[model samples]
Target: MSKPQVLMIGGGMIAADQILPSLYQLQRRGVLGGIGVCAQRGATVKALADVEMIRRAFPGHSFRPYPDPATAGDAPHPLLYKELIAALPPRQIVIAAIPDQLHHDVIMTALRNNQHVLAVKPLVLTRAHAREIEQEARARGLVVGVEYHKRFDDRSLLARRRYREGWFGEFKLGTASLMEKWYYRHSNFQNWCTSENSDAFSYIGCHYVDLVHFITGLLPASVSVYGIEDRYPNGNKGYLWTDARVIWNNGACLNVQNSLSFPDGAPGTNAQGLSMYCSGGDRGAWLEHSDQYRGLRYCYTQQPDAPGSTMFAEPSTDYFQYVDTGGPGLEVVGYGFRSIDHIIAAILRVESAREDQRSTILDEIDAAGVIATPSNSSYNEMVMEAGRLSILNGGREAVINAHEITLR
Candidate 1:
């Protein structure tokens, strides 16, 4: 069959850091055909050099600029969306890995065009928005697989397969945690940071939240979340976490926190882990995220009924010793890889698009809400209403707040 065509949206940090590299891989292998990119500015990602960077990895034609408005988020910029819409062939696969704020508008446009979308995780700002976008997607029979990559990793996949294969027997208990702080004081607060509802709750903790559902094949019948925004506008909680904790309805729990103003070495001195046990056997492992290191690591052990024996195991990999955190510090390098890997798999999954073209209730509602432009007024209203409901209910409503309702 012919390779899938791609339209890359956004040339921000992720484009520079991960998507550009992964696209290069797909193109070289012949799984991808031509690539057209959309960036508000004259970013390198949309240039001819980008074309050569992957499938056509060598000098080709000069980078062509779509007649897009020159300014991002500058609505008055002429031809911004119009030029982008006209620049590509219809039905090209779109990767909506842009900033969270732009998630609604970009994905909505692509879906309306009937192009399949690989939306990044928690890309929707609210559950109501997720519901609306999903409704439209379902009606269109278009695929909207989320970007939850840890679910796609070979190791995590093995764990799930073993659980299903009866290797671990029956599962009764499962637990996961990500504890480390990576907040910067100088972080930009208004545009991208203010709307963040994470002090680890959504940012750091949600990965494992979605992963548990993927690996154990169990949903959190319900979840109770608690978080505090200590660092605030000053950047106390950095990017992912300032402080947070969560407990799942299945009795599984997720605990995470950004290092408070604690003295040095507090975050590293601690360990983070995931453990699950059932009738015949049990297994658990620790996760180590490093910036200076070449890769990530996972170490786990399975034990028989006996207390002092080993059924099997995967040993840990060690490669760190803080290069000396100066003040209110964190390593940004190690944090974004998980997002990168997820993007790679999501693109591949949507590119194939040959599943039974079916869906479970859970899969269809995987999104919270889909926010789009004024044309998508219904969805925009959904987000606003959900937020209002959250505030008025004191976070007591499940129909609106999954994490908070259980607490109430």
Candidate 2:
């Protein structure tokens, strides 16, 4: 069997930061075949290709840009990804790294084309779409993995194991926050993450929601999100700040706050962490993770040219980074790369098996719950849907049952 060719559907910040570099490393390691990237505009794909960090980290590695890198302009070809997905060979990989609202269509396109998928977090905005994608992929015996990279973090894995072993008792109350830097206002987020489409909670906050479930086998029963609307630099209004309360099935409550309003000059890239307090008989246990400050502080002579970067920074070594290890090009390391590698490996595992055994492999991947498949992680879609509903309706309570999400 030939190595699977990989095509990324969106060339945005995530594509530059994690996905593309990870793919380059996989290509370098002979894990994957040719790579391609399709974006709405040629400039976006060109910019991703020209990223200095990626270029320095992976020399002699590049991707086939969809809009034709030779013709450089801001012309938008919104439907180009459809053509590219159709052109790919069956049983290859198609990565959906686009906006939150666009995940379903792109993922369905891949599945319909008989291509496996690795979608960004919060697979879709609703459980219905998730079920649709799940049924489609399962029927075709293809894998669809959601990129909840935080689950790949060793801390999360350890906490999950320890908690399940009765070390931390049962999760009772928790709080999690992930705030992006203020500079995000000037990016394409201003256009897509508007009042009508999505909010900060639905975008970044879903990580913690999913993480809580990943750590403890609890399902959210109700959610209420109060969003504060603010305008971007482009004069478009969005729910820039959000505070949410999620009630689990065991009557546990989790408070999640998310925003793109963190000061750019702050020492860390963003403010994020999770704190869970539990109880058992007369004993109480606590699990706390200061995700933003990873115990490493650097004072540089000059501030990095990267947007929202500070001269004195608390950099996280766990998320994603490039390091030299006696090689012609730098190597990509961290949980981000691990998450992508895991999903691609799962796809390869399924593809390598005989046709009759492929279904069993797919079933095993979903049952293991190590990777976030549509079948295993559709609760995230429920939360996203409830969040959007609550945010739009003045933060009313949105209840999540087995079948549907309704407001109270």
Candidate 3:
């Protein structure tokens, strides 16, 4: 059988760089059949583009443009939504990459009409919506999933292996950090470099949150946060922060701090890294600025040297040399160090659903959007709680319930 037909809801930054190319590859391999894409007319460069790009990539695939509600340009072309939705073949799986504010409407329409759905991260904007979507999909026996791809990374996979194998003793504390400056100055890049939005905590930091779960296999029961507001604000979509923190269920916690507001906006100099603490295993890695540490990047780990030693040293001769520099001055972004690779992998499926194991990670993705709380409704409440705490409560409190958490 050919790849199941796919319908992409948003055609912005993620679509252009990641999902589109990936799906086009799937199509070429005979794993995907017809493909359709809809991007509202007035979105920023990240999420908006002309059809020529898609046409050139998937020449034979069906591609179209619809008003994207998430973008400012969609206002004048509201009718395109239904037109795009209605034109799709019945039962085709829909991949919606829209944000929280708009997910409910778009996804519900598809579910009510009997289509499966694949959603991007932060599944729903609120707890209520989470419950609602979960119930709907299960009731309809349809697939619905959210993307959390950190679990797919090499480092993450090793962490999980050590945890499961008991290479680490009791697993006392785990800390994860996402720090860096990925901001764009108005004068440097063109009208815009890429991506219309880059909220440190919600958007970028979410990856670390997922990583916490991946390494420890422990889901956060709740989180209390502290965040910052950005100056440039990523093409004006708003909310780029300097730092954030999250405490999980096992009493082990995580601290996530990120800033697009770096004094220097280069990847190497802007620095971001993670450190984890466990009983038998303790590990950490960091980036040295291009000037001081040029090509001196490394990832070193250490175990207890003796039974009661309070200190640690390099366990063996194994360490990775970090190579995060390639540009002069401060514009090394032109190099191939874009985190966009991770984003692209999330949109792609390496194998057909049939070839994938049932009840595996990929299958879990389909179940991710389903909610255990809010009963038969969506998790709009939980999202409201997160949003409220983020904007109003000074990040001291976040609305999250472990029992109510829909997916692991």
Candidate 4:
């Protein structure tokens, strides 16, 4: 079978850091055809194309930048992705790595174009939108996978298996945190992650929320989020700090704290981890993951040029890292790359199956639960919707009953 062409709908930090390189590696291995990336402005795409790390790592590999990077002016072309999606051949792949609010439209566009989609976490802001996408994709026999990279982490997979086997018992209570560096206040996040659009919990904290479900199979039943509003360097206000309480259906509680307030000089890129306490009748159990620090510490002679980088670093080997394997460039390792590769491989599996059996293959993919799909992961959207409503309403409790979300 011929390889399916790939189109990336966003060229921001994720594209440069994880998605594009993963795609380049697949291209290197002959798993993909031509790859193209389209962004709001030519400058964003150009910046991704000019990333020195990517150039050195991938060697001769590059993506076709949309809007003609040379002639397209500084003005933003928000609808340009529509045109590019329309032109792609049927049953190709489209990666939606845009903002939280824009995921619905871009994903819908891809599905309408007869394309398989791999979206970043928190697929959409609302459960209704997630259901809509799920229905549309299922009707057309297309696969829609959410890129919750944490699920691919070995720690998470092991915990999931053990927990299911009654090793960790029933999760009774937990705490999680994922605090990004303070420098995020100055990045493009200042423009989009505003008070009206998203908050710390809805943005980064959802990882733990999803992780909890991915590990325990328990659905979040209620959410309450208290957000602290702060001004970015660009003077835009956002919910930069947040504290949330999530109650599972079985009466378990998970407290999650998130913020863009980690000190710039901190040893790790970010501080993140999960600790869960479970019950097993006569005994108790526990699970903990210090994800930010992976036991490797380095006191470099010189600090890196990136903002907020530190001379003393505790690099995480489980997320995304480039290591020399005596190759032309570098080999990308970690759960980040593995997550993207897994979704693409699932797409390839469906495509390789007989046309009449494609639906069955998609069903099996969803049932296997290895890769997150709208049909199986819509609870994430429900939690996001609940979090947003609670944060906006002064931390009122938002109850999720059946498929609806309401504040109390």
Candidate 5:
């Protein structure tokens, strides 16, 4: 059978930084095939530049580009969707890394075309859209995945196992804090930073939202959110910080914050950490990853940087090694790489089955054996919209239902 084709939608940071890099890595290992890209006419230059880089690096591979104009003379020109539908082969994978709002439209089109899809989180902006995407994929026996990459992290996988084994006891509370340097928001994503499609919490908080659910198997029943815009523009312009208190149906509270207001002098590009408390049966267990260091911290100290500088000390290092090959080859593992490799493997498996007259079943299980399917994104979609509605309703509680979302 011919190698499966790859079509990447959107030429965003994710496509350039993570997705394309992983694809090229797969190509290096002899697992990838022809590649295609689609983006808006405005993004053509960037998209083509990326394609050219890949083409030059890996010669002899077919790379096609289709730039779509938002509108034409007559009907709306969804050139990307039209071209994809008309030409996407059965043995193909569509990586949807577009803005959050367009996830539903682009992903649904791919699924309706009977192509396997890997959509970046939050999969869609609403629970209904997630359900529709899932239902369509199931009906066509196609695989669908949401890029909740954190779930593939070793710490996250460990937590998931402990939760499944009832070792974490009854999950009582989970608090996650993550912040990116100001440059990321004000510069990196400046284009659509405040377009209502992307926000600090919705974009970054989706990781923890999905991670908490993935680890504890709890669903966010409602969310009470309070958002603040410190330096960025306000009122549909952009949000610099967001804090949400989510109540899970299992009587667990999840506190999540994603701030794009980190000080410029900060040491790292981003800081992230999560702490979970539980009812212990035997002895209390504490697991936490130090912010910025990504390792365990033992103590803190106070030492001034300058006369008026803030004194801070975290006795930690980037010593925690999740995977070490001691070199580079096909068995080298890291959850980030594993997550993308999992998608590639799933696509290849489906392609193999189709070619050998075997059943075409694209399993959704991750490397950790957890069920990391796209349907699990329903809660993510809910929490995102719930937070948005909460902000719109003056920071009141935004209730969510499995069937629909209501702000009260």
Candidate 6:
């Protein structure tokens, strides 16, 4: 079978930084064939026309402005689901990396149009929308995956293996945190950060939430959260920090703190860590730290004060340092890229089986001793809505049951 084609939606940071780069790597390796990008408006789409990195990587590919610039130029124009779907091939894979609010509509539209979809994290704002999309995808017999890159992280994957083996003994406490530089909110990417549908919790906290679930296979029973909205002068007016307690069905709990207020001048650099304590021993087998390193000269500096800058070194971790720069191999095997690749491979595998009149993709792959699974969007959406309700109710416990949330 030929390599599957790709139609990437949204020309924002996710598309540019994550989707496009990953696709370029895959394209170089002959895993993915042709590629296209589309955005609602022309401004952002036009800005990507001359992107050197993308142009250098994908030499012959060109960006296509969907729904026409004249019509979708305004903010929040009429939903262009029909028009957008009409422009793609039936077997094409739609990568929806647009805003959080539009995820449900775009995903459902693509699935209903008989195209597989790979959506970004925090698939949708609410569980209802997520379930609606999942139902549509399942009804159409198509693949729908949510990109929760943490699941593909080497350390996190190790933890998952150990947890699945029942080596953790009994469920205990899980602690996770994610911190961004103080200037992140004030940067050019604040467009979606200020929106009501997206915030620090969904933006950064979703990683840990999904990580906890993916690592331990625990279903969230209840959640209680307290979050503070951004109040800086130019900061986006949304949840800048979130603290939450998630109770699993096994009576174990997890404490999560996500913040976007880490100053650049602070002693520690960006904060990203996870620690899970089991009942078996004093030492925890699960600990993933992406902060601080030794003998690293990389530092933070505003100006070159002397021959060598004396600015403090930012938190440095070689988490994604494995790359074969010289050849046509998996140049970048970071979890972020691996997450996207996994979904694409799954979709293509299913498509290939269907073309050969196979009974089922799962059965076919299983007979061949292949094990592949993508993170469930519905599950992530359910937990996110529960967290939202917990924050809305002033940290009151919110209950979750099989991808549905109820404020208790």
TM-score for all models, in order of appearance: 0.60, 0.99, 0.65, 0.99, 0.80, 0.83
Runs of candidate 5 with Cα error greater than 4 angstroms are 42-62, 68-78, 230-236, 295-333, 354-371
The candidate with the higher lDDT, 4 or 5, is: 4
Compared with the true structure, what per-residue lDDT tens digits does model 4 show for residues 32-81?
99999999999999999999888888999988998778999998899999
lDDT for each candidate structure: 0.45, 0.94, 0.49, 0.94, 0.68, 0.68
lDDT of 3 at 25: 52
Better of 1 and 2 by TM-score: 2
For model 3, the run of ten residues with the poorest summed lDDT: 328-337
Off by over 4 Å in 6: 55-62, 65-82, 232-236, 265-269, 281-288, 291-324, 327-330, 355-359, 362-377, 402-404
Q: For model 1, how does the per-residue alpha-carbon lDDT over 1-408 read when each residue is reduced to its tens digit?
A: 256677767655455444554554455446667766666555334443453222233223222343343433333232254356545565567777665656777778887887667666555666556666777776665555555544544455667677666676544555556553232223233235442433334443555655555555554433333333344555444233332323334454443333323222222322344555555534543322221122433333544332122333222222211122442222112223344434444445544555453333224234321211122222222322333333333333223243332224
Comparing 1 and 6 on TM-score, the stronger one: 6
Write candidate 2's Cα lDDT for 270-362 as tens digits.
999999999987899999999999999999999799999999999888999999998878999999999999999999999988999989999
Count clashing residue pairs in model 5: 0
lDDT (C-alpha) at residue 91 in model 3: 53
Q: Candidate 3, TM-score vs. the true structure? A: 0.65
- Model 5 poorest ten-residue lDDT run: 315-324
Looking at model 1, report the run of 10 residues with the lowest lDDT sum: 368-377
Of the candidates numbered 3 and 5, which has the greater lDDT value? 5
Local lDDT at 178 for model 3: 52
